[model samples]
Target chain A: MSNALSVKNLNVSYLGNVALTNVSFQVDEGALVGIIGPNGAGKSTLIKAMMGLIPSETGKVEILGKPIRKTRKEIAYVPQRNDIDWDFPIHVIDAVMIGTYPHLGLFKRPKKQEREWAYQCLERVGMQDYGKRQIGELSGGQQQRVFLARALAQNADIFFLDEPFVGVDVSSENTIMQILKELQKEGKTTLVVHHDLSKANVYFDELILLNKELIAKGEVTDVLEVNTIQKAYGNPLAFMKNEIGVKQA
Target chain B: MNFIEAIIHYEFLQKALITSVMVGIICGVIGCFIILRGMALMGDAISHAVLPGVAISYMLGINFFFGAVITGVLTAIGIGFVSQNSRLKNDTAIGILFTFAFAAGIILITFMKSSTDLYHILFGNVLAVRPSDMWVTLVIGILVIAGVYFFYKELLVTSFDPTMASAYGLSTKLVHYLLMTMLTMVTVASLQTVGIVLVVAMLITPAATAYLLTDRLWVMIYLASGFGVVASVIGLYFSFMYNLSSGATIVLVSTLLFITVFLFSPRHGFIRKVIKSRKRASLAN
Candidate 1:
């Protein structure tokens, strides 16, 4: 009952071609878990399936010990940057206000309190001054911060972010990490689909290493060892190690 | 001797003017969503697909509005089903369905005999708009505007980011279908003023021009509606004076405005980019 997330025997496919197979894991409340894998490893697919964003033939996902539909508002997800149309005609404030929309229900516009709250969320991401600017005009880093601000505005207990660091500046990465840590301190559970192997060790308390199937899952130190990484990434590490001759040294 | 004073003498001119402006506002408002979602082709597809509905309605001796709305929604759904269920892409689905419907319409028109000119439905004659046609446009115009006002944020969030929209329990799929229905309604409403061949242009051009001019979506919608009204009025004027096709004239005017914005928009236009780049080059020197 205390678990923030639980997945059992989850299987997903696209047009009968299996994308994920028998993925199972559980995370306690307030845990910072990283879902890491190689490209085409269903890293995004797994999180999406658990969140019921994609249909699964057979699976069970419990959020905060309740069915996903019942607790939908308690969960927030940020898709990959590339998944969004950056040229969309909207302002930063407009983008952030979307976070408050689900709660506003249909037929009601965002009020003054919601506007101030959206602005406060922007301030948390250091984007308060950029509120009036068009979203498309923002840099990659600033755009990611805007998404973070939106997620902050959602005020959800469980967060799912897919590659929040991809194509972003180093400072933005640091800022996102800081925000994730802050979310953890607030006892919010976060699951980030991260692709960067180098940062995995420092970024997560628990790592779910996957390559279409779960290769390893547990504490970062336990799951991100050389063997587990090699298992998930395959023989590339051997080539990388020989080429660099550094990890072996 | 003035154009407005002269036109006021004729009831047909007044009806045409009212119908054109109503179509303008509806198409303009809904067109903003179509443009923002990059569903212009969908708008085109629905517009083209409604032809058979008009013909069928003529054959049934019923109001073409109901028939057109039914056919438009059906075609939209069929397009969605094909794109989602099969390997065929969206444009391919749209192409297959709209053309088939259009061809069926052409064939059906050969069989049906009525006062409704097939030519007018194909290329609208706004001057020929009857009082009933004007009333249809009025009702549909009010419905489309009210829909946008009520569901503004849902459409905004869903169009911008469906992932986030669904995460927030907005039912992105439902929102999408709602938008398609709205598009169909707009296309059906515009059938009298722009005709099927030119309805998509009315739906896309004014909104695109507005996009080039503004960053905020509400402002874009308002500007697009303004542009739509302007184009309709001027196009009506020219069509009245020169005896040109009203639908084509309206579409052409909107296109001209879009091109002007594309070339000269201070924020995102080609000329602005050129000016900024030239300044940077001079600074480098």
Candidate 2:
């Protein structure tokens, strides 16, 4: 089977500061991979580099075994909510409909069927009532739901999401995970830049731990051992040896 | 004279009415993008900046539309350049360019000292609407509306969520350039009716008023165009009655409309709140 996404020697820079160095990873079809690291660990940069959202200095990224330049429409991207301006005049439904632009082709407005599809995507993420609400009116968690709805509306085979669960409520977080599980069941590949180590283990089928580089990759249980977790996160059982371990997350 | 006989008596008034209405339609349609992109003041800046371009074009005996379009595009490109190349903020660059261009226009107007219809340059000559000016605006207006419709979604998406648009393979840079080009055309086209000083009022006030009345972008566009037309007609009437500059009168009407909307909008206005409170008190009693 072809890889859903492949990255090699992916390094990125920002203002003369090295953000990511010598990173390599690949996602198999139907995989839910979580990339976790501390602040400034370039987890977001890896996603940006892979999605071609930010130009990479040196690296190669392929989507569905084809270069990003050629296969740009085959992938979907969900940036962190804060990455976009909430005060923009667009309503939630319109924002979700934009996900179809890549497939809609230039100068082609979304037809009635496409709009209904957007409505269904909103219903999928519990944003049905918010179809006409301006994005500025949504809460952080609700905005994340809108972003997820947008990605779902894309109907792409591979999805790249940067920090989808950040600042989300427990209920919203679980809903997002359930959505991701459904995507995996549908044979879609999802690469998420996750932060909370607690849910990272339970949520992701495969975990790619990183600290500005590819530190470890494999099954979450195998690669998330205390020592490796410490190496990747600068912590070993730091939240362990307690009854509520990973519970306060 | 009977009422119908009085209606078609004045040819200049009829010409003013026609010229100002066309200018209103073009500005209202194209100004929607300017308002959405928060580049409302850009129209004022470039309108004034075209002064030197116009004078030079006149010296060479070329079409002033060519000069206005060239200068307007150049000014917009300069702002685009600064926004991309430097850390300087967009409004700061706007302020810088706004001053330099307006000053250049003022200096040029003083130096030209030509009797070739200075009223048309400074305060707009709606009554002096020539056939060539009408033809230029009609062609350009059609082109602008068509361009906007072609990229309607792309421009809307980019204006609303630039990052999401770009991520989805839509080039926000290209959209930005297209918007700037449209604005340049709109400003140059409106020069004959609104003049440079009042162009911002024409470009921003209608949209802002319509923005207060509706949350739907499409509806806002429609309402704004209507408001612009109404304001122009009212202004033309006043200009004919009181011997005032039609452009200034139109801007004043637009300002009054803004005040009305700002003070009485149902959602956020104080008067609306007061009325709602009174009604609620009566219901409780």
Candidate 3:
């Protein structure tokens, strides 16, 4: 019923070129929200700015009615898969353990309790068996699942995933979506930067359409309208009509 | 005297052995993070940049460690500033700044007309390592080792994924600068054993060898340090026996170890991949 994340007048630029402009939206607690846009639509940039991963030119991000800095521990973010160096020497479980870092802080080591919780998080994603495998050794879907397990281990109130399904397989995608739905049922807010428009309506309780700015933000049916999709994507998607039940104008 | 007897009887040999081993351990530890972060070139840059600092310290009648660390950190910041401010890539920045610093060092040393000290500084003579320098290396070894152990999590996260680290409110830049400071100290400590030119070898080769041998980071750290010690001990023996340069010999030994592991490591080795694919081809028949 209450807003879990609120971004007001967000503006971001890359090398003096605008990446995102005047983007603003609010995500309610216990909702799975999908951000959909064309390529280079600044979907990832929007999420990064909200998480304060990259500097935003002008914006205000509040999580749980507090500034992001004060509520950092309550937010979990899984960056795009390509942003990671797959060959880095780390075990699946150890990578998942990094999710506990926000809770562990500087000097404290992860105790047995934290380790068990990390393992449990892995179990939640059905990746408990792959704990000892090298992260790079896994298939793309398994790698994404492992990352999702790590974010689950964070125990954060809100989750943001950037293009999680980009290279993922169907089974892992289903597994990830199921886990995300479970998180929503547990009253956690989740915002996913999704590339597949076909699954957008099914996966998210709400949708935020973006194209360097906020085009639409509301229920799936409302935001997936033909006019809004054309505005954000710059073309009428003939395939989207059947996909989302969008009546052609 | 034989090597063991020399080590037992001569205090200079004892100092050299201890100092070289300490350098080995710390370089091995720090080098794991360095290579993992793909900053091996940065390692090389910091090591060379210390030359001007060493020259300045000699002129000032002070310990070169202080001067070397200051310059190393400065070079790091300078590289960062250049690459961030300009269109030049990170390697370009490193190359520009380190060469300038190294050239400045050569000119300073030339002005001092101390070719003998320059030879030892350029090509380290661990045999001539002083007791005070030995103590400095030991202290630095402890500090570097302790710093890594205490900040292992932070380093792991930042090196593995900076975006996640920053999102978690861990200051990735702070960790980077902190690692650079530790690297400067390690380079300064290694000067009497490996010298600036060869120190990056000690930092990278042993860790890379360990990388081929393990998938887990902690295992790699331990194995890398173990390889570093083995190379130091054997290299010192060979250098002492053959009347060769200690720094060059040590670097060569680490390189040999890397080659051996590259060929034979069980999981990620060249030979193993060849054998497995050959077996798979035969199985198809």
The candidate scoring highest on DockQ is 3
Better of 2 and 3 by TM-score: 3
For model 2, the DockQ equals 0.49
What candidate 3 gets wrong by more than 4 Å, as runs, is B282-285
Root mean square deviation (Cα) for candidate 1 = 2.3
lDDT of 1 by residue, B192-267 (tens): 7788999999989999999988888899999999999999999999889899999999998998998999999989
**Better candidate by lDDT, 1 or 3:** 3
TM-score, B chain, candidate 1?
A: 0.96
Candidate 3 docking band: high
What TM-score would chain B of candidate 2 score versus the native chain B? 0.88
Put down candidate 2 lDDT per residue, B107-206, tens digits, no spaces: 7766778645556676775666777777777777788888888998888878777766776677888888787777767776677777767777888898
- Segments of candidate 2 deviating more than 4 angstroms: A137-139, A232-237, A240-249, B1-7, B115-119, B268-285
Models ranked on lDDT: 3, 1, 2
Task: State each model's CA lDDT, in order.
Answer: 0.88, 0.79, 0.92
RMSD in angstroms, all models?
A: 2.3, 3.6, 1.2
| Model 2, residue A175: C-alpha shift (Å) | 2.3
- The digit string of per-residue lDDT tens for model 3 on B216-279 reads 9999999999989889888899988998999999999999999999999999999999999999
The 10 consecutive residues of candidate 2 chain B with the worst lDDT sum are B1-10
DockQ for the candidate 3 complex?
0.89
